[model samples]
Target: MPWYAPRHLEEALALLAERPGLIPIAGGTDVMVDGNAGAAGREYLSLAGVANLRGVSETPLGLAIGALTTMTEIGRHPLVCRHLPALAASARVTGAVAIQNRATLGGNIMNASPAADNPPVLLAYGASVVLMSAMGSRHVPYAQFHSGYKETIRRPTEILGEVIVPFPPDHAHHYFRKVGTRRAQAISKVGLAAVLAGRPGSWECVRFGLASVAATPILACALAAAITGSDHSVPRDEELAEALGRDIAARDDIRSTADYRRRVAINLVREALAPWRSQGGFDASH
Candidate 1:
């Protein structure tokens, strides 16, 4: 595919609308792989010169992270680290350092990979994507953005603008763990993001989202809701694992068996909530 760098998003959007075979390329980390394999005779809109689609800031709603914000920046941002620690942790482990330097949060989300680390974290944080077109702009929750494996609801003419994540409550804690073939530079076999709040005797919020264990990354809403109001602190790991095994719709893939992913998802849930067993509340440091 031939490449053209658009100076502005409007130009890119216009090109996308006019050119039936145009592909948008930001980091090109994921796109190029397909393009290199003879998915050609098309044009690519490079967003490197689009200045507006970059940066991270605190917004009235929460944090507004620009579509082009790199994983490296996301991992190191003090604001991100302090508030959305799971996201920060996810970004840090998202690839090797070099890929992190080039990978954008928007690209990561737009890729819509089942194993993509950002989605689990962002979904757990209740994040939304700001999508803009020549017509107008709209916000879509991360959970709803992905419709299927490697597929998103984004139209070709619409550009992903930014990500909005509401700040979790001060009492909230987060955990992100990925099971892969290697420690780094390997795709996730099973990834989990868990967030919890409140003290031992009372439970306020309990959310768990897992990647590479379903058709699309999922927030175990039904199960989370089931345990949200309970006073029980030491999680019933076995029962929870059984529930996960029964509830999660997983399939055997090259990474692992569906049964294995199901097992890991349950264990991740248990481990993430294990901190509550101690004297204080959950801890993110672990």
Candidate 2:
């Protein structure tokens, strides 16, 4: 198979327009895995040489993280840790240190796996993705980007350029956790990334993004609504369980059963909101 490494974004866009089946590969972590499993393309468009697509920068909206920015960079970047702590936490738990060094955020997203780590955080943060083609660029809300399992709205001529993430509101409670066989390297059986805003009993935002329990990573809108609508600081387990039934489409898979995933997901949601239930709200000092 032939590989083309384009040093510029324009050159890469040109190649995509000219070549019919060229797969854009940034970190090549997922691409190499696919190749090893005999499910890769005949040719690949290597974006590793595209220097423009590899850093995090400030934008008017908030932060513009280049598509090729590695997990290692995101995990430790001061801006990410300070502004989007949940994202930084997610990046830290993505695979192992070696994989984190090689896995790009764009690659993690474009791979379209329900078990992917960072996407849930992106969803919880209300992030948007920039897709660029030779024609121009367009921004798609991350929530609407995925069409189905292993599928995305990106056109063949377009490449993911960057991700735009707005800062969360003041005093927001950020929670991120992944339930896997092991702590570090194992794929998530159920992963959650959430941001809770506002005071107890009178909630504002309850954004919860869940993984490995649906066809694609999804925001648990139904469950969030149940929590916000509740009279108590947090909704009861029974109410949460019912709401979760509508939010996730868990299926029995090799890693875990549908019932087990659903149970764990609900438990995680309760555990995340324990502070709100015990105390009036989460303490910002911590």
Candidate 3:
């Protein structure tokens, strides 16, 4: 296999334009696994030496995470843990330390796996993807980035440069949960994330997302509306859970049956939203 390591982002973009079949390799964890299994074809564009594409920084608006930033870095970053703990929590469960050290956020999203831990949390945070191409650059909302299973909106000439996440307001509470076959080193059977904004009692804004239950991570807009507009100060637990269960469109798979995943997804939503109900609403500290 041929590997081209560009020193600059522009050079990388140009290379991608010329060689559309060249897979971009960052930490190489996912690509290496596929290569070892004879699933990846020869030739790749290695982004490791691209000096501009690394690290996490706080921008005026929110946070800018380099596509090359490893899961290990994100999971332990003080700023990320403090501001977006749900994302940090998702990063912590991506894989063991070794895999985490070698897995990049860009690779995770570009891989487009329904079970990728970060997507649900990113969706809940209203994140965006910074895509670069020889033609130019553009930002795509995370929700619109994924087109289908293992597919994304990124053009062949474009490379995912960074992920931008806006800081949540003070009165926002976030939660994430994943159901897998076992407690450790397991891919998710079902994953869920929720963000509630405004006072707990008021709940002016509610966002819910789920993974491993559809073609891609899903935003449960109807469910969020139901919880946010309910006349009851606290959501009706049974009713909300039932609504969540019925909202999912999962198909039977090797890891779990469709019915089982639907049940787990609903239960996870209830679990994630419980804190908001208990606190009498969203807390600023969240």
Ranking by TM-score: 2, 3, 1
Model 1: lowest-lDDT 10 consecutive positions? 277-286
lDDT of candidate 2 over 1-286, digit per residue (tens): 6789988889999999999578888888888777353354477899999978888988889899999999999999999998899999999999999999989999999999999998999998999999999999999999999999999999999999999999887788899999999998999999999888766565666799999999999999999888878765566789899999999999998999999999999998988787777666654643
lDDT of each: 0.82, 0.90, 0.84
RMSD of 2: 1.9
Candidate 3 achieves a global lDDT of 0.84
- The better-scoring model by TM-score among 1 and 2 is 2
A best-first ranking of the candidates according to their lDDT comes to: 2, 3, 1
Best by lDDT: 2
Per-residue C-alpha lDDT of model 1 across residues 1-286, encoded as one tens digit per residue: 4877888888877777787466777887888677353364767778868978998899999999999999999999999999999999999998899899999998998888888998898888888999987778999988799898888999888889999999887768788999899998889989999888776566656778889988888877866755653455554676576556654788898888988887777778867877766644653433
Q: Report the Cα lDDT for residue 36, model 2.
A: 51
lDDT of 3 at 248: 68
State, as a TM-score between 0 and 1, how close model 3 is to the true structure: 0.93
Q: Pick the candidate with the highest TM-score.
A: 2
Report the lDDT tens digits of candidate 3 across residue range 74-140.
9999988888898999999998899999898999999999888999999888899999999988999
